[model samples]
Target chain A: MSATHDATHDEAPIAARVRHVEALLEQRGWLAPGEVDERIDALAAGGSPANGAAIVARAWVDPGFRARLLADANTAIGELGLSMAGGLQEQQLIVVANGPDEHHVVVCTLCSCYPIALLGPSPGWYKSEAYRSRVVREPRAVLREFGLELPASTRITVWDASAESRYMVLPRRPAGTDDLDEGRLAALVTRKGLIGTAAV
Target chain B: MPDRFAAGDRVRTGTVDPPHHTRLPRYARGVCGEVVATAGHHPLADERARGLPSTPRAVYCVRFAAHDLFGEGDHAVVVELFEDYLEPAEREVRR
Candidate 1:
């Protein structure tokens, strides 16, 4: 146990602490030696912003899917062969749609809780204390910082993930893309748009 | 347990300042907000953290005006809160 701690000495404090805990779990027969890495690799492999983008593209083209997504996200995503059931608990996913009059943004004020299985890993800024606090306090100002300036007439809604449910923004499709296919539409959907920091 | 709140109900959050884990963020404590929707039952994260046995409780999406919560922004903040963290607020009959 002590040797494992020393073996991670060259790593950062947080990484070392994580390694120490993993080593302890392995030693106690609670986890296999390489199980943690395998799980992490699997998670990384499973998640991607493209998955979210594809869903958005489908929603853009299919009104029925869009309605289904707005009503129940987990089930709607399952229609696309995607799911929020990555780990033990199947987190409740709420899909908030951004409309001409209202825009939606997501933040985990307590921690960096996110729909990672959908949007891939959260951005560095999303986890920053500055974003966690300021976005909730002054969303328009923060969106301005992200180079997004909503019209004065537009209402902003910030979704704080403080419990079991997670949220994702369904950004309105951009204009002049009517000729584009679903794949092209998906290509236009950026991670920031899905997070509601930018318009897609 | 039955849902204690419904969509469109006015509720006020509890100012619970326990040292243990809680899903209710400090920013939302004691604030009055409207219940916009209900998210079905889930175990209390606080109880789970403390190793106390807990039954799943209904969660609600509570919406507060930015002017009410932060005093300046022209927006709304929606926070998902457990049933225990909220109580029926005195109705605001005065607009």
Candidate 2:
């Protein structure tokens, strides 16, 4: 009898549980009806790598903006109306600049904690256990797998997101694109470049 | 609580493994690193994970040399660590 009951209700247990919780929250007056769906939809709609690319493009064109971004990332992004808000607790944004002699890469060994509002959802590989573990241990080798070959002289700094802060890499502006406008430069930036897995 | 660490201070991560949830990565435990920057105070996640009240503690961006950490690389790794995870280590004269 128990086996039959379990067989009939085992499908989509997680989703069913989520609905149950949402219903409970509504019943308790803690959440409005459809609030969960609305929030999820908002997150999904905001998910895009273009957001990060735009920030990079702006930094490439404006020295003052770049300085501000390096000094304080959350406020700097606000100038463009981008924010890391809307979550339960605000996550801090930390921007690390890539220089001629230095490079930056980010990883979350504990989990796939990233700046979703700024960079959209994280790539699948970034959340994979292999990437989470290997990137911090053998960054150059892992970056080599991504086809990023940095010279021995160029130091690679791996930023591990363990706490509330989220990091984004500001790749050095590529050479020979002097005539490009900010929008064009933004178009030239790639998601991988913003994550420091590849160059712009 | 007042901040116990600042940029440029040498510190060592605690090695004793706790049974509860923690953000301290296993590979980084017992390692010596330098405080590169202060990341601001944050509630101790270990306590919060246990459903206990947690006050904000100082956090730091600690930089560890790849060579020292893994015994063979030339680069470096930086981790955002809570104050409770570190202890002041003797300063080294050379890099």
Candidate 3:
């Protein structure tokens, strides 16, 4: 057989590798059986807050700060004392602003890359293979699949986040939110908004 | 080790061999940016990339202009990455 075929045959499946790691961790006493399930449950219960939402709310209330954030996201985020680590540390934070004639969506063509620091661990739908592959190549169509129908005249700016820079979609503030406080504005920012599927 | 770059310092993303652990995205390769801030060290993702033990290393969040990422007229965007994903931005400085 050719070397390529031999290599392919030797490669282990991802699920098996994960299982092996789990077994090794258990054998070494580093992890207890059923601990994985418990940890998963805990993570689910502790839903991460929407960091980008908080930033957007601040921006909507204060135009000057919004300009600063658009100019430099790191400093703007630092103003809020939020640390950038995990996937965020590996990528830049670009807050895409939605306008009357434009909408932005983000995707990682390679994997489920996301701004967990700002938006939290990716939801199940975001991690789906269908979302990753379809979003970058056919954003408008995919948005439709998510039940978001945009105007044909509206321009779609798709942010393909394939590297260390992550993106957060800044949905236009909802009507009647002009007088809302920062806290209330933040509550309106949802993961869907960050993904550019829903407006806050 | 701490970050090799600092806020306001301009740096360029360097190319590294593939099949290596990297926080640098394929799209950001060769892109230039200003070091906006430094994030603390964390377990390296290289271990998972190389099938070895992940080592801890310093990470930083750098900001790149939108024009730099996409072209002119494009608004700016910022990306945070670890030191391992970066190299000296060609122009070395005395730290």
Candidate 4:
């Protein structure tokens, strides 16, 4: 009898339950009538890696801009008239630079806290417990596994962004691109590069 | 609006195992490190999460040696920590 009753439902149970939640929120004035649609629109347009790429490209071409970015990342990024502000999580963005002998990588051991506003959604591997646990303890081995083998002489510095200030790595510019413009340079910057897993 | 810690200042994370909302990560508790940069003050998200007023607190980027937290390696790890979660560690103080 119960099986027959379940099969007779016109709508899927999950869909019906969601509709019930929507109706209740609207009825209780907890959510304005079209708020759901507005949020969907906002989420769709947020978190693009192109934003971080552009910032990195500009820093590469202009030394002064790089200085400003290193000194105060949030303000320097704001000068571009685009927000580096995390959605619903107002974290301050810190730009870490990679040099000849020094490399920087970012991780949140407790949770996957990252600058989603600029770097876009985190990659699946970055959120894995294996990554969060092992990266800080054995960054060299992890990066090597990720195909970014570094020289023994080079030092790897990991940035654990655990608080209100998020971090992005300003990857050392790759060689043979001296003539490339900002747009071309930005094309080479990948999400992994910004996270310091790989170089640009 | 002044920052409590400046670059090069050595500090230690508080070991307060608060049962409520906190921004400090467990791995960083009581670890001593040098302040690498001053990121100014920001609202405490932990307090805000618990329905309490978020008084702005100074935050700093502190750099810790690999051995300090993980017990091995020559590499370093920098973490962003709030002032309330930190206190001054003993350093070379000249009279």
**Alpha-carbon TM-score of each model against the true structure:** 0.92, 0.91, 0.58, 0.87
The lDDT of each candidate is 0.90, 0.89, 0.69, 0.85
The local lDDT score (0 to 100) that residue B70 gets in candidate 3 is 49
The DockQ value obtained for model 4 is 0.64
Best model per DockQ: 1
- Local accuracy of candidate 2 as per-residue lDDT tens digits, A105-157: 99999989988876788999989999998988888899999999989899999
Model 1 per-residue lDDT tens digits across residues B1-95:
67988998999889779899999998888889999999879889999999999998998999999877766788999999999999999776322
Cα lDDT tens digits for candidate 3, A124-191: 88888888765644666777877888887777766656444667787888888777899999989888
Where does the lowest 10-residue lDDT sum fall in candidate 2 chain A? A1-10
Considering only chain B, what TM-score does candidate 4 achieve?
0.87
True-structure Cα RMSD, model 1: 3.1
Q: Which stretches of candidate 4 lie over 4 Å from their true place?
A: A1-20, B92-95
Residue B7 accuracy (lDDT) in model 2: 94
| Residue-level lDDT tens digits of model 3 in B4-63 | 777777777766757654666655667777676665556666566667776666666666
lDDT (C-alpha) at residue A16 in model 4: 78
Model 3 bad stretches (over 4 Å) = A1-47, A86-91, B1-95
Quote fnat for model 4.
0.80
Candidate 2, backbone clash total? 0
Most TM-score-accurate candidate: 1
